[model samples]
Structure formats: structure tokens, C-alpha cells
Target: MTDSAHIASGHATRPIGGGGGKIFGFPLRGFGLVSSLLLSFASALFTFCVTTMVAIFALLIYRANGHAAVDMAISYRDFGFPASLVVLAIALPLFLTLWIRAKIMG
Candidate 1:
């Protein structure tokens, strides 16, 4: 076989960018594989932060109005209820989204 012919065939067999190939001119494999997980984590963290901020504001307003009991109510069992609410607020939707994503990918 001619050297040119052998070289052409080798080029054809080589993966685009050496296993870093693009799909329809868009690179979405390795990065996309972890993007969903990363997004979910960020979303959950944001939810928790926002919820805590809201709860703190609520307590402050109540405290200013001379009803300190506002803090203790939400702090039931040392903030367990409010914390769990925030977690569920983030987790439920995240779980459903990831589940749907897996099904769609498969």
C-alpha cells in the first residue's frame, strides 16, 4: 500500500480530538456528563441559603416587634424543622429532575 493511502486510513480511524469528539459541531460529552450534577448541587445550596435568609429576616422582624417567640417557633428542636423544610424544598425537585434526565438520556 502507498504511504499516503495508509496515512489517510489512519486519520479516518482516529477519534475526533482523540476521544474528545463533538456532536453536531458542539462539544457536550465530558462536560455535560457532570453538568447536571453540578447544577443540582448549586441549586440546592442556593435554595438553602435563600430559605435561611428569609427565616432570619422573619425572626428579626418579629424581634423588633417585641415577639421574640418568633425565633423559637421556627427553631423547633434547634432549627430542625426549618432546615428540613429547606432541604426538602431543594431535594424533591432535584430528585425528580435528575430522574427525568436519566430517563431521557437512556
Candidate 2:
């Protein structure tokens, strides 16, 4: 068949290479690594902030429902640390994964 017909029928497709091309003299692989790290860091920060805010609101709710101020502090002390850690643990990795995928695919 004709060359155009062969290519159109998927008879001339090439395999993908592992080493990606560079951009502006910077390697795409390195860019992906750096971007993933930055994204993970930002995600961790955002998750921590949201977790802290939620914990504070929960404590406030408890206080408004007749608990003492000290009770709020105690509740925060009991649960806030682990909650923040858990959020960071989950969100940071997920953000990093998505960033890496986007960078590599694009």
C-alpha cells in the first residue's frame, strides 16, 4: 500500500523512549523531579492549614456545646496532631503523584 495509507493504518508507528527531550537546555526528567517536590511541599502546607482550621472549628463547637475552654485545648491536644499528620501523609503523596504524571505526560 501507499506510505500514507501504511502510517494511517498504524503500520509505521514508533515505540516511545525512556529519556525525554530537554526544554530550554533543562532536562525534562529533572524538571519533573523538582516540580513534583514543590507540589508535594505546597500540598503538605495546604493540608496542614486545612487540618488545623478544622480542628479549631471542632474545638469551638465542643466549647459552644457546654464544654470548657480547657476542654477544647485538651481535645485539640488529643486529636489535632494526628489529624494533621494523617492529612499530610495522604495529600502530599497524592499531589506528588499527580504532578509527576502531568509533567511526564505533557
lDDT leader: 2
In the range 1-106, model 2's lDDT, one tens digit per residue, is 8778889998984334335555575443434556766755665566656666787788788778997674555444566556656766786676566557666676
| TM-score (C-alpha, index-matched) for candidate 1 | 0.42
Query: Against the unseen true structure, what C-alpha lDDT does each candidate score?
Result: 0.57, 0.63
Flag regions of model 1 displaced more than 4 Å: 1-31, 69-106
TM-score of every model versus the real structure: 0.42, 0.48
TM-score of 2: 0.48
RMSD of each: 8.8, 8.8
Give the candidate number with the greatest TM-score.
Answer: 2
True-structure lDDT of candidate 1: 0.57
